[model samples]
Target: MPGLAASVNTPFYQQHWQQIHLPLLKQRQTELWVCHLQCRVPAIAGNKWLKLKYHIQHIQQYEKTGILTFGGAFSNHLAAVAAAGKAFGFQTHAIVRHDGAVLNPTLAACQEQDMQLSFVSPQQYRQRQQSGYLATLQQQFPDWLLVPEGGTSPLGVKGVAELQLNNTPAGAADLICCATGSGGTVAGLALGHPQTAVLGINVVKDPSLPEQITALAPHQHNWQLAADCSGLRYGQFDAATLQLCLQLSQQDLPLEPVYTGKALQTLLAALREGHIKTGQRLVFFHTGGLQGLDGMLQRQRITQEQYQQIKSAELRLWHQFG
Candidate 1:
């Protein structure tokens, strides 16, 4: 692991194997293909199902294990961490943002997974990597093993690096695309595939992200950022974009109105603009966000009736065509 400074959890791999990766490998048999999954938190859930089972089993062999701590209120990371903790008999602590008093859906999910929730002011939460802050928490929970937020550390990157192992579809993939929030997943991918170009589709409007990515993996080139804002504020969505998200969701590739949807939009736009040329394989990482779909649909005022109608029509059309 190149970035993790803490004791990393391994149960996520098992969860991902069961939920996402195995199905993906089974369904997708093309030589040259595209992956729309990004580095969203749920992506970790899928990864957990696909890969972490063995690691969990191995960790069980060792004694003197400690609790794993990570994440914020709305974070799918928190949910995954919580689930992983419960399954592995490790105590879990979640550091959540102090935006509000109420727990978000993800935090509630974490609660169900038996993760203890702790709230810190947004500013203090931002200082998570600071020595003073971490030291205080370390002192408080001496037995707790820390995991970096969003799991962007060296150990986390090690988990992500598994994506590149024994998983190529056949022909050379010209480009690998992902959405970068903390930059660890892309960093791991870049490290794993030095020859293939890695493209990051940023959902946030962070001007410093390119430099951040470069800093994370200085030795790796052929990685660049695609600046397509799509008029979304971070974690916020617009009408047209929400429509696109709904459309994509209807296509069985459910995407949230946040990062993954924007990344998908960027990828499609790149294809239209000739940036992602035909015959050049593009793999868009479909980082998981099925949970976020609830918030997105709620915010967009998308009704269940409408969803049923649309799905029904699409199914009918598909049946007719097939």
Candidate 2:
């Protein structure tokens, strides 16, 4: 990232784009607007950018030179941290929640970004929040700024709050929807726009998700969390989820299970169950997780070649990373 080609510019901050005329949007009869946050930055796009938006600012604000964060093998947060550290001139290290030697595309890509990897047992990873655990890390890497798992710091909420909803769908949205990871994005969004109902479709089966997001939100805004539509749970999908992923990908809406797909499935199920009113406009945020797709495919025992053969129709545009 440091001395990268000039023509290969990836901006840390850029203007958001609004896309319209997608077929399903019309059929839904809603003023649907999607912030193509994926295109905002090539590496740290979508909620990853928002999550790290203020973390980077915090590091710079404190005049730090190193960063430390936590994640699993397929963590989007870890990937973003690695990319941000390389692009913005910081030493980055990832405390991965895995044991033994693990070689995968996500970690490989992080290495390509010049991120240092440290493998830890799942139990140790869970101790990330304990005072003594953090103190040990502080003693080990005294200069590195420690970021929580999923980058869900209070600063992260502030970064997500900076996202301004465009006037195009400004007052028209009856329900603003997004996929929840660390719950920072939804908290920031709900705090930023308190009037609209925020329906956050959670990927994991955690029951405390709502309380967690509510506690993080600066304001107790109108919001709801849907945990029922988890389809085969996080990182595990069934025939229905695969079908939905295929359907959305064919429409140029790439998704991964940990976030986007579950949100989409929840929304569609809501519409089908008549939980949403006929005239209500549902603004779905496409929080990009294309980076995790290949990892999920491999975890499902499908090779990249097999996925390519299946999505041949959508391959051309896939190169664009849309």
Candidate 3:
């Protein structure tokens, strides 16, 4: 873990998962234990760290020159890559969607981390896996290890499976829930905690999300998905969604709508729908995406005031309601 080496500024610890008992959960029959991975490291924290852990090691194993990965405008994955590259001595390249040289906060931060920016149109990025497309990139960036979008390789799965919960009050979790983007996080969780039933909240409406999870990690213990909780579609957020994000942020679980926020919303909705039975202990994985908030505000997915409110919530306190 050279990236998270014993540096004074490293917010992440060797112990990746921290169990926090929300005061609100005690009121209900169901118990909620949140594993806060969002603030795992000073930068490049959260579930992305779990996803990219082995990839970085792969780069070291192969003695690769650099890493090239794919992402959207405000991709937390790319930001994590940039941060990781900075901490480690590897070059980073991002094949991002949107055909512009705009130095948005995310991209700018990547640039600061010395990640080379490569802009591709949405259509071209969509064809990223189409035979000649990848071949061309291989030819152009020879010697570069191309990490798949969201860094969801088998090695990545192996890396994420290493993340375990500590300080478990009553031991194992009855249910583990996470936001499903590329299905890597849930796949890793399923593989790691086979005894626990895992639920994935679809942040991106992919009809084939389950299939993707199956492909990444073949398992039979339990892999369930909860859909229609992403505020209509991917990268879109509503006022209520923003409010929930703020609420969670005030509780020390900062999240953005693209990933973590949607998962929380889905969990609450599941509770309301009676999907979560009483007396069951739930462990929710807080996949980080604080870097995406600026992009969300810029795109008007969330208002400026809403973002500010989330940032300035020191006075807000959590109260348990019965």
Candidate 4:
């Protein structure tokens, strides 16, 4: 099967103190208010069950289809491709970055989805967009169909555009926010609807993102990019960001520390600064990454004593109120 891991977890709304904490924080802010919009990506196998059923159906219509290849060891794209391959009877190959020494949760989930994984050097990985690299792979697996990394090809973008169009609320919103790893989702959303403004918060700390996004969308002007420099290093947490993540999660808007936490911070800051006006409805798109939170929390150096104190304080507060 060429799709995301079956064991891969999805995020759900749960009752937690973090959810409660956020509303209090919002109350502190005189200008900014928060609103959340939920959207679902394709399942592990790159199959958009609702819209892309026809495409999957078409793949099934062809008997000679062999393999589907894409990028990201821990990518939802990999999981989706793997699932699609397994369900539609196509071979799946995941070309991953060489530096990924240990299998992260997402990768583990992808493996569970039954995708064959291959690692390549960082230099070779850079050549992923080149025709020569793809040519070599095609020569090796003559019948394989190459799907670009993050599924950013025309077909993929089309399906993504449809998803964005369908999920966007009926009325006007001040901003539609999402975390951008590959620019595909943002690009598709930008293309589908021109009326609303789309803001992408980059989890990756690349300074060149503005140029990169512009290259991907040269003519589009309504799109904006907000980089999460708080997590200066990838997969590493900063104290302030972790605290914010913990607080936001308590607010009924549980945000993953890496991407959404930074986004929430940016959104709130924008609201406080009057960047976005009051009564201007904003919609935040939550791209799922709950597994990453566990990895981040595990890396924290907090001692048992510190954890106990925090827990004790929280319990005392609850008891006083209740």
Candidate 4, number of clashes: 26
Per-residue alpha-carbon lDDT of candidate 2 for residues 213-282, written as tens digits (9 for 90 to 100):
8789846668788874755666666656656766666655555555776777778778767787766666
- Local accuracy of candidate 3 as per-residue lDDT tens digits, 122-226: 998987657788888889989888888888878778777777742456677888888888888888888888778889888788777788789888755577888
| Reference-based TM-score of each model | 0.75, 0.86, 0.87, 0.70
Please list all clashing residue pairs in model 2, or write none if there are none: none
When summed lDDT is taken over every stretch of 10 residues in candidate 1, the lowest stretch is 13-22
Alpha-carbon lDDT of model 1: 0.59
Largest lDDT belongs to which candidate?
Answer: 3
List the candidates ranked by lDDT, beginning with the highest. 3, 2, 1, 4
> lDDT of each structure?
0.59, 0.72, 0.74, 0.55
Higher-ranked by TM-score: 2 or 3:
3
Question: C-alpha displacement of 120 in model 3, angstroms?
Answer: 1.1
lDDT of 3: 0.74
What tens digits encode model 4's per-residue C-alpha lDDT throughout 1-322? 2343231233212211211324523554322233332223324311222122323444455543544555544455565555555655556678887675577656676676677788888887888778987888878877556666766555554555654422333355556767676676667667665777887877766576666556655677888877664647655556776577555434334555566667667666666666666655566655544444333434444444434443454345334334
The segments of candidate 2 whose C-alpha lies over 4 angstroms from its true place after superposition are 2-28, 38-41, 99-101, 169-171, 300-306, 309-322
Instruction: Please list the residue runs of candidate 4 whose C-alpha ends up more than 4 Å from where it truly belongs after superposition.
Output: 1-73, 87-89, 164-170, 206-219, 229-231, 294-322
Sum up the clashes in candidate 2: 0
Model number with the top TM-score: 3
